[model samples]
Target: MDAKTCLEKLKLIGVLSFATVDTQGNPQIRNISAIHYEPDGMYFFTARGKNFCRELLENEKVQIACFEACPAKVIVRQPPISTRT
Candidate 1:
């Protein structure tokens, strides 16, 4: 699927797993529900003092996975990108 289509699917899916790395280089995964899609890029929200928020601040590298069990199935791999929110 195209980038726009993939982003649309992400919105439709709503909640998805977001993975990040900590200072120790250990992988951490969390569920993120607040996601916004724009023409330029995708954005998500987290509280200021949250661990996940700190993780993002220290390491911008992250991954998102969307799983849909329906008529159609898709898995998109998004590269690591910096985010500020």
Candidate 2:
């Protein structure tokens, strides 16, 4: 899907799946709700001490996906980015 449509789908979905890796390198996916969709960048919240946090610290690469009832999907593959709000 296109960028605008993807963003709209994300907002409609509200919650999304964030995938990370355990120490052994297995895939771990979790449901997340604290997210903000910005024109310049997207924002999401998770505790710093959580496993998902550590996974990002250990491996910068992360995968994010959000799907809607219309069968629309948005997949993002990139390194982790941290910014103070």
Largest TM-score belongs to which candidate? Answer: 2
For every candidate in turn, the CA RMSD to the true structure comes to 2.4, 2.3
State TM-scores per candidate. 0.76, 0.79
The collision pairs in model 2 are none
lDDT of 2 by residue, 15-37 (tens): 88989899998999999999898
TM-score of 1: 0.76
- Span of 10 residues, lowest total lDDT, candidate 2: 76-85
TM-score of 2: 0.79
For model 1, the superposed segments whose C-alpha errors exceed 4 Å read: 71-82
Q: In order, what lDDT does every prediction score?
A: 0.77, 0.77
How far residue 3's Cα lies from its native spot in candidate 2, in Å, is 4.6
Model 2 scores what on Cα lDDT?
0.77
